[model samples]
Target: MSSKSDTIQVGMTNTFACSYLPEQQEQLLVLQENTLNVELFEQLLTLGFRRSGETLYKPHCPNCRACQPIRIPVKHFSASRRQKRTLKHNRDLSWSIVNTTSDEHYQLYQQYIEQRHHDGPMYPPSRAQYDNFIQCAWHQPQLIEVRDNKELIGVAITDVLPNSLSAIYSFFSPTQEKRSMGSLMILIQCRIAKLMGKDFLYLGYQIDASRKMNYKKAYQPYEILTANGWQQSE
Candidate 1:
C-alpha cells in the first residue's frame, strides 16, 4: 500500500468478476489504511467510495460506466405518493438504531439471504461471512432494526459519517413481500439522516441496467456522481 497521508493509504485490486452485472469484470481503487476515522471516510464517500467491512473501495472499471454513485439531498427530498403509502402501511413497525450486531440480527440476515438472494454471490450465508462483511475494525456501523410488534423483521446496516449516512445493506423477511421492507428501510435511513442534520444519504452505486438496482432512481432529486461532478437527475 502507498501512504497518501498520515491517516490514509491507497491501493488497487486486480480485476474481478462484477457482482452486480453478468459476465462483466470489475476493478476497484481501494483505501487500505488502518484506524480510519469517520471524517476521512465521509470524504471518501463523496468521491464514490463505499465500505465493505473495513475496506473502502470505488469502482474503477475500464470499460463500463454503468455503476453511478448516488446520494439524496435530504432537505430537498419529497416522498412520492406511493412512498408515503409505504410509510403509512408499515407504521406499526418500530425501529431502533444501535452500534453493535447481535445473534438475532445474524439469524434474520441468514434467512433473508437464503430466501431472497440464493442466486446471488451472498447465498448460503454463514456467521463468519456476516462478521467479515458487516463489521469493520475502524468503523462501527449502526444497525437499524425494525420489528413488527415483538417480531424482528428487517435490518439496515448503515455507516454513520460526519455529514451523511451511508446505507450499506438491508435485508428483510422474504415472506413479507407486500410490506416492501427493503424500501421501508431506505426511507427510514432518509428520515434518520434528515433528523441528524445530515445533508445527504449516500446510497452506494445506482446501476440503471439492473432491475434490482434501477429502483434507486425512485428516490427523486438524487444526484449521480459523473465526470462533470454530481449531476441531479431529471
Candidate 2:
C-alpha cells in the first residue's frame, strides 16, 4: 500500500457547470500520473478520490463543499424497514459478479441513460462512451449483473480493492423502477463486502442538497468523511 509519504501529483480542472446542481459551478482536483496501481488507487480512495475510467479525481469546487464522501461500515449497517421491503420485493432477481462488460450490459446502460438520465450529461450514450467511462486500464472492475427470471435488469459497476469495494456506477431497467434496483445494488455491495471480510463499501459522494445524490444516507449507520475525519452518521 502507498504510504502517506508517497507523492501523488494532483492538478485542478477549470470550473464547469455542476451536473448535480443547477446554478452552481464545479471543479475537480484530478490525479496527474502516468500509471496508477491498485495499491496507490486504494490509498487515494481513502482520501476521497474516485475513479472515472483511468482518471482519479475529487470535487474541488472553491465556492462549495457539498460533496461529502460516504462509506458503509459493513458490520454496523442495519437496513431500514423500507430497504428491507425493497429487498423482499426484488427477491426473484438474481445477481452475479463478472469481470468484463458485455454487449447486453451496454444495451441496458444505454436504455438507462436515455430513459432515466436524459437531461443529464450521459444522455446520448454510445458503445465507445460506455467503454471509456466504465473500464479502467489498471483496475479490473466487477460488473454485478442483476437479472429477473433470465432477463437482464440491472448492472452495478464496482471496483474491488484490497479492503473495500467502491461502487463506481449503477443503472437499471427504467421500466422496473418499482424494484428500487438502485438501493438493491448498494445493499448487494454491502453484503458482498461483509462476506469478503472487507471493512467498508465506498458509496462515492453524497450531496445532501442534490436529491439524486442524497439517497445514500438511507444506508446508515454510514460514515461521512469530513474535515475532522470520518464521522458516524445515525
Candidate 3:
C-alpha cells in the first residue's frame, strides 16, 4: 500500500534536468484497488499512470511534470542488427505465464541481483518481499517468460494499464549473462505491443547519467512528459 504521506515536488529545470522533472508539481489523489481490469488499465496507462503496492499514481508532483509516461511506438520500432541477433540467440526459447511465484524465479532473481546489482534491494529478498514486489494483489499479472527447450531462462513482470504496459521488474539467470537476455526480453515486449497495436511502452524512470539506468534512453522517437504535455525526445 502507498503511504498517505507520499508526495511529489516539481520546479524549474535546466537542460540537464531529468526527464521526469516537472515544472509544476501538483497534487493528485491516489487510487487504491484490489484489482485492475485489463481494458480499464489500457486507458490509465495511456494517461501516464503506474501502479505500485496498492496505489496508482500518475505524474502528480508539485511544480514539475517532466517525467513523461513513455511507451514503445511498437508499430514503428525496428530491431537494430544487434537486437535481431539477440532474438536469434534465444530462438530456442519459448514461454508461458503462471499464477503465483515459483522457487525457480526467486532463485534466478537472487542470482541476478547478486551478480548485476549486488547493492540492489532483491539481493536477499524474502518470499514475502518478492511477492509484494512482483505479485501484488492489486494488479493482475501480465508476465512474459523467455525460455528454451521448456527450461525457464528469464522473467519480465509487468502490469498492463489502459494505454501502455508498466514493466515493474525483470530478471534472468546470471549464468546466462552472455545471452543479453535482458535486452532481448524488452525487445520481445516491443513486438508484443506492436502486435497488440499499443502506442507506448512506459519504461519507468530513466535517471539521467546513472549507469545502471542508462539503457532506457535508446527507445528513440519516444516522448517525455513535461509541464506542457508529452513532447518528443527525439
TM-score for each candidate, following the candidate numbering: 0.95, 0.96, 0.74
Best by TM-score, which number? 2
Clashing pairs in 2: none
lDDT of each: 0.90, 0.92, 0.66
The best candidate by lDDT is 2
lDDT of 1: 0.90
**Residue 166 of candidate 2: its Cα lDDT?**
95
TM-score (C-alpha) between model 3 and the true structure? 0.74
lDDT of 2: 0.92
> Which candidate, 2 or 3, has the higher lDDT?
2
Q: Compared with the true structure, what per-residue lDDT tens digits does model 3 show for residues 1-234?
A: 276443222223233223323333345535555455556556655567666655556645555443446656666677778888888887878866565567888877777777887765456656677777565564676778778676778998876555566677788887788889878778877776666677777776554545666676676666665557667765
Order by lDDT, highest first: 2, 1, 3
User: Residues 1-234, candidate 1, lDDT per residue (tens digit)?
Assistant: 356455455788898888888778899998867768789899889899999988899989878889999999988899999999999999899999988999999999999999889988888899999999888878899999999997889999998888999999998888779998888999999999999999999999999888888888898889999998999988
lDDT of 2 by residue, 138-164 (tens): 889999999998999999999999989
Clashing residue pair totals per candidate (backbone < 3 A):
0, 0, 34
Model 2 residue 172 CA deviation in Å: 0.7
Better of 2 and 3 by TM-score: 2
